[model samples]
Target chain A: MYDHKTRILYVEDSLADINLFKEFIDDKVELTVVSDGQSAKSYLHRLKQTKSHFPNLIILDINLPEISGFELLNLIKKEQRLKFIPTVMFSSSDNQRDIKDAFSQAANGYVVKPGDLGDYSRAIETFMNYWVYTCKLPQEQ
Target chain B: MLSKVSTFKTVLENLSDGISIIDKEGKHVWINKAMATITGFTKEELLKSSPPHIYWPEEELDTIMKALGETMEGKFRNFELIFVRKSGVRFPVLVNPSPIENDEGEVQYFVATVKDLTEVRRVQHELDDLAYNYRVLHDNTSELICRHELDGRYKSVSPSSIRITGYRPDELIGRDPYEFIKEDHLEQVRQNLHEQALAGNDLIRTQYEAKRKDGTIIWLDTITKTLLDENQKPTELVTISREITELKSLQTKLEENNRELKRSNMELENFAYIASHDLKEPLRTIDNYVQLFEMRYSHVLDDKARQYFEFIKSSAKHSIQLTEDLLNYSRLNSSEFPYKEVDMNEVLENVCSQLQSRIAKSQAKLVYDKNMPSLVGSHILLSRLFINLIANSIKFKSEEKPLIRIAVKETINAWQFSVSDNGVGIPKKSRKEVFEIFRRLRTTDDEKGSGMGLTICKRIVEKHQGEIWIEANEPKGSTFKFTISKHLKESTNV
Candidate 1:
């Protein structure tokens, strides 16, 4: 019944937040979770080396154990094979400085994590509706 | 003829000054009775003594001999000498010697007259001391003392003028005193000096800018008095000037530094607004998650787990409220908001309407004047101030019904406002502490607040260059009084 589900690479440190996102966005998309920027980088590197299919989108958190979301976005944008993939910043920070920095670094989208569970679920559902179903994303080479 | 000579001798003896005659070889040939008293020797002993053996002190012997030689050459000479007496006492003497020449230019007796000068020398020494003191005072004082003619020309300047103006006394002596005055201050100084001269007896003290030799401007404070002549007419102007350039510049620098410090403080307040705003996001997340947990698992969770979840939810909610209030407090200092003309009556009506349910529940009797004037301030901030005060009155009501009275009086350059509430009054000591951020006098569960309302009100009042303070009301309760200026002196822009 889950035929051709959209794939997403979620880079986050908090297990509770990851579990919450998974429960909210359950069967709508196939999710790959990495706790840190380094692991996310290594996972992307393995995908490229194996000539495996790239994820449909990348969701990056700003604060991480190793490399930050900004550095990861820069790395992704620099790679010839990964530059076309859409990257969205997912963070709890709603600071103007953070928002401006995310946009200036070529992040395709930025979303603040909602405080309530219902709102968080609704925000994810809206993001999926627009990015996954309504809009046409570039096909993986 | 013999009696005539005797009468002449008697007349000479009665003279006050000593009188004697010396020969060309410096021998005492004759002397009167006064000479005998002055020399402390008899007239016979003086006549018998020779030049080297006479009463002349050793230091005066050469001067006496020189005068004797000069007199022998037919030239009259006057010399000062110290003479010793037979009793070893010394006195000052002025001696005049002249040659007596006979017929055919042949020199006869060389006659000399000696006068005691002890009293004359004492009077002359006193005059010399006074002149020396005047000279020292003129040259040694740090103040630039100057004597100027009535036409403003410099008659003389003290030695310190060279240190202050970089010009010697001679260089400035004949120049017009106005030449050294800065061009911008020349007219004012001229007018002041002229007025002081006209006033005659009135001394004038004033400050003016002057130019040094290198063309740098300096400020000088001068006290000027007119020097009057014998007829009491103004003759010269005497000015004592002290340099105050350093003090003037220091005052200007202090003002500049104050402005700079105020700007830096504004920037810091803006930073606080940004920081507190950003802090609210995470707090909201934590609060929501805890609420979600409690709502979804209340039936299945154990009593202790439920209590923990409740504590987490409450703490998160408290933090969110605190951060939000902190943002409001800092925003009061933010210059991003513009000040406009706001009517206080309208603002008060709006506040009453917003708190209508609370007022009705608490049975608050709100009173205010219908005719309130318009003031210059932020409309949002002023309305917020009223809302906070009125809401506080309702929240902190005592056993009796709440009565909140808002009044305004027009003061000079400002409108004075007071909001009096008949409520559980703030304690005398905590009246000041209540205005501090996060400081609440009442910590009971019923009186809930983030404790930033009064702080925000105070900041808003201060931003308008006004003051806000609390005082005890009549009979009971607390009254908050503040002022808002009608006129804004500076641009309230970021």
Candidate 2:
């Protein structure tokens, strides 16, 4: 049953947003959460060693503790093995500079958190439909 | 020739020069009428004197005898000497002597002619004094005065060259002035001179950087003029230069400070934008949670609980609007917006349609001319400006259907626009205070506004390099008047 599901790794610092994302996903995918850039980097490093435990998708928050999402994204894009996995920037910031910066750092996509619950739910649902159903990803191994 | 002896004697008597004949024994044998006048003596006294006569100054008697002995030997020449008159006054004279020969060719006596030289000596002394004064002025002045040949070679340089260029006059003369000019300015200087020559400009002023003899750079302010010959043809160029290095450096420092101030101001605007952006996240969370609470527990909630939720939701929404308005206000000062030609009529139409529901609900009518102008400004900003004005007119209506008139007038250097409204007018005392940021006449509970609309409009006008203010209408309303500079270009920035 788990083998057929998509795996997602979320790196975020806000507790409210983390809880919201957990509720929105609702076991539709195999999700793992890390609260800071350092732990997320450690988890990715371990996944690189295991080779078969890599997630199909990664979601990064631009503002984080310890290390910034932009610095972590730069490190991930530079690694040959991790560069294959698609990374998306999910943040409440709708600033054009942040969006442009995300793309310039080789992020696969950018999503702005909506202001209301209904809009946020719809936006996440659409995002899941696109990434899990429509777009294809590299093999886990 | 023998019969004309008397005529020769008559010519000698009338001559301007004094003439005398002396014997070998130093006795005066004959004298002309000029000689008697020149010696200040009668013929009898002059003829009676022998050697050391009164006509010769006593200080030069020995030299006079030596010269007389030389002249008696038939070796005649002109000599300068001082002669004393009988009145004891001494004067300079030029004496020319020749021997008088007999028929047998033996020297018998000497004939001498004397010319007065007092006027020539006096004029020579005046010329020498003038030259001394000119030399004193040229060497002592602080300005670097120089004369250059037509080809730019230094013909003469003042002593001040040492102070201005760190070079002595000897080192600079005969060298091309271009050699001392900085390489970056060489071509420009050459072009300037070439153009002046072609136009026959008598005087031109220019400034440029130059390298001194010690390789230190300095700025020179120079004025050059062509020295013309008698035929009005260009002969040489006279240039006067002064060192302006201190002034140039001060100007450079001022420019640098201006750039630094602009950078810091941009940073402040960016800070405001980012702070407002961060503030929105928490507001969104509060709004979403309140809505989620209502969706889950509405059935069990009473009137009081529902009222509290509504208050929380509305407050969150209001705060969200405030942050968004602040963000847009900051964006107006940034360089992201493009300045281009925009039609005011189109901008007004866009603003009207955006506020169509509000306008209809309030039964407000907008009267505007269709012949609006195209101006250089940001289209989005101008539309926002109009929307805020029209919306305020509708919002503050005074128990009557609102009538807003948008008009434009052409001035010499700008287009003045007026937005008049038949509504509660602003008091004269509060007109200036309304433009201040976050300053509102009405309380927040009475008016549903972020209090940033007028502030944003003021910023937009300022960005266009124009002014905006309020004027009381003739009877019972307020008119908002603003101007747009007709000469604004596409590159203008906030």
Candidate 3:
């Protein structure tokens, strides 16, 4: 009865993350991946240019090349066309101030990237389950 | 007393109030004309009316007359009567009866002075309204105004305090004020109040955080003025408390907002400084390129092209200098400087030594009165300030060899210094503009300046809680006077 074919975009640079996300998702959603900030920007731009259906959710990494996640996040949140895309920040460290700032700025969620594969698998599973069923996936514009 | 005196009888009957006469037999032998009019009877009709038979309950006439007899026997008394008129209408009458006697001194008649009770009733009604008004006044005021017992119990409270504390008058009456304070803070509150009382000081007001019955805390700002007992000893504390929890919260929010604004301003200032710092490298590169173009290609280009190259170089350099000065100005407000006593003579010497090249170029006459007073300030900042002012006087030189004179004197709690120059005199209107950062009122031809020297002097003076101002020098020049207060110490708080 649940929407299992949800399009979830993991805007992260780590290859290990792609593997860990696959392990937890187990064909639950059509997982998409982008390696760097420019690629993420290009992927979103392509979706808009071709009038393709956008991803229902996005998980953004804070540390990125070319365009930092802070700037990209600001850009996305400011755009009425893209603001409805659910965003979860995938950070490498647990910074309370960063969490507070993110929350105060209305971030949908925050997830710390785990170090080892076991921790990564568990973290991926938690995030997958949280977004898959815990939140209502957005409809395309 | 004589039976033949009918004129005397007529005089008594014409009185406005009720009047009556009784013969020795205690019979209602005669009633006055006015009395018959008030009783709804003619004098002819009242003459036939008997004493006990004429009045209802019949006992009232007899009992009052009996009391009147005692009054007539030298024990005077006064009383009112609601007597029935002959028409069966009830009315009010005041009777005052005096004894009339025969020539032999035996009792004969009783005469009295009477007044109607209508006005008395009206006055009583007005008194009732006044009492009601006071009752509302006592209930309506929200001043927390209350009388207290000598032992510090709330004797009474206006309804206002009930709304403030969510407590009924009965609940607060016997309770000590300390009970409302939080348990951990109760002793401190008690001790402060006790100390104030023992010192014979009225606790005019105090503020503290109080706990409510629901366990929520509120900041209580109270004013307690003492009252003297009948023996003239301090007895009670009349407290007026306004629940300042909301006000205190608002104050906290306002303070936080102020801090936020201050931080944002600092960040913006730092941004400006960083931008200026980054621009300097490019500006230097631009200046170097312009000079290279002039040196390598001046023979190939027209005079106009060479002149254009010079203007470009100059404008770029000026902008770069303005940014640097602006960075310094903002940094002054953003950074705190430590204080030390600085020797003005040393400062002037250093400034003069730095401007040696500029002084030599002008072949300028520089006069330094080395016996200047010592000032308390930031040594490095003060030296820079002096250097800037002295250089400006040289830079703005008119046609003649510039004459610059520096002098110092001690004033109340401060030292004032004047650096007068016989250079280009600044106009009065343009003086204010000169003290604004990077503002130049005159053409850049006569002098090339960052236009921030005077502003930097202003900043330095302000940092020391001192002042710097411009004045017209005699004949044709400008004078820069600056004062440094001796109390130029660093603030204890950041």
Candidate 4:
């Protein structure tokens, strides 16, 4: 199982989610934030140039400004270190067509970002509880 | 007296009809068996009839005598009256009298002949009943038979005209024919009619619009003929016309609705073209970016990661091909592709020459015979149609050798051409399904396909009013058979 203080990379566009996620998850795990795909891609490239910052998990959004979330997912899925990181699709659209498309692209899991704070809290809690506590993850030291 | 009595008896027996003789004093002087039978009386009872009592009133007899007195001077006289038989049967009679005078100039005797009129009267009654029934039938059905002089005056019109046009026959008697036509279209109607008539042609079964008394227009489907006078020169127009405006209006509306539906379909096809084209831009960027990463860091990607990258690269390339096929399919439905006669033999040769390398590498023998009849259709689309079929035949072939044979034959309406290949054949039940998008018969394990080629072929064939179907080639192959008609205009003329 992954450690309680495993460093994680979370790429998100919403500031409120950033604030809420940091407040909820900072005590459970170390969270490194990237505001948009540009920062996320740049950070990833920088890591590739030196020692790889292999995070335990990566949460992705499908809709991004410069590059689409799908393109980033495809890129990460193609990488040796990142392909096994248990990436989850976190998007605002609950469209069934988009969901089917995500699964067809072999995504690990898809999570719809609800506006309700309670639902968001439950969803985030469930995702973390399964991945961090119950299920096993690579804990290479 | 005895001799004269015998002579009178002989005269009465020889007459064809019932006859009686009465003297000047109006007493029945003689009677015959024919007269007794006709009057339904015995001969013994009919002789010695009272003056003017049998056939006429006493007063009418006096008037007859007065008229006959003038005719006695030199004229032949005729008289008619009704007589009752002994059985009370009544019949009309005519009497012709010839006066015979003595030397003293006194009117001594007048010989009168009486003829029964029942037979003639029976015939006349039958004729009158037939004429009455004919008139009633014309009135009920709104059929008017009109006879007009060449000068366009009404010679005769049945009472039926009133019910049809709300105009009495008398009112139409002197009216001009052109006056009945709506004023706006009157000139055109007149020009058409005058030209036909002057060319010695009778306008038969023509349709025109006429204004009623209230200015409401109605269509008249009329049939007319020429009426010739004694000189045999055409002098009149006799026409039969019925109304059909309501039927014509309904047909016009139906056609208009069909036109609107067709326009909407065309707009949808245009949207398909635009969406397919726009989706390509982003796809190109991903492909280019992925290529850059591979070129820059070939050594860094581990075997496991490299395998994942290979899948992604293949997916992008496959997507681009699918997009092109979709674009081509939608482009066909976007605009009206004007067509002309295209020679199939020439088209097949050009396409084969283009795909020569694909044919050589696959060891495929593409055989297309020459002298195929010309088909009337769009060359560009037809060329696309042949290229897709030929490529598929070449692409999917038996491992040893790929052989394709192209042959053509003329059928009832169109020319049938078959492109047979030694490639894998589609199953019988799945033949129709092969024409749908992404409906690959075999799994993509061996060969990849978009499954749009047959669908495109079906669409193009239908547009030309033709058909396409699949049949099995000998051994192990599928033969694609399609037909396009001989030049449509030329076929219609023949």
TM-scores for all predictions: 0.53, 0.56, 0.50, 0.49
lDDT of 4 by residue, B320-343 (tens): 667656766777774435576777
Ranking by TM-score: 2, 1, 3, 4
Looking at model 1, residue B347 earns an lDDT score of: 86
**Model 1 lDDT at residue B360:** 93
Candidate 1, residues B294-368: lDDT per residue as tens digits? Answer: 767789988898788777776787788788889878767655457877888888888888888988988899999
Q: For candidate 4, report its TM-score.
A: 0.49
Best-to-worst DockQ order: 2, 1, 4, 3
Predictions in order: lDDT: 0.82, 0.85, 0.73, 0.72
In candidate 2, the residue pairs with backbone N, CA or C atoms under 3 Å apart (3 or more residues apart, or in different chains) clash, namely none
lDDT of 3 by residue, B1-494 (tens): 55767876777778777677766544666677777777777777667766454543354766666765676576656767667777676656677777777899976776666666766777878998898887777677555566566555688776776666677777788777667777776666566654465345775466688766667888877666777768778776666667788889999999999999989988987887677755654554455455545656789978888788778977977876776677676667644455776778888788878888888988998897868877678777888888888888887888989999988888887788888999888999887778887787565575767778888889888877778888999987899998888886654553
Report lDDT (Cα) of residue B71, candidate 2: 87
Per-residue CA lDDT of model 2 for A30-102, tens digit only, reads: 8999999999999998887776567777889989987988888888888878886678899988777789999
Q: Would you list the clashing residue pairs of candidate 1?
A: none
Please tell me which model should have the higher lDDT, number 2 or number 4.
Answer: 2
Scoring only the A-chain of each prediction against the true A-chain gives TM-scores of 0.92, 0.89, 0.81, 0.84
Highest DockQ scorer: 2
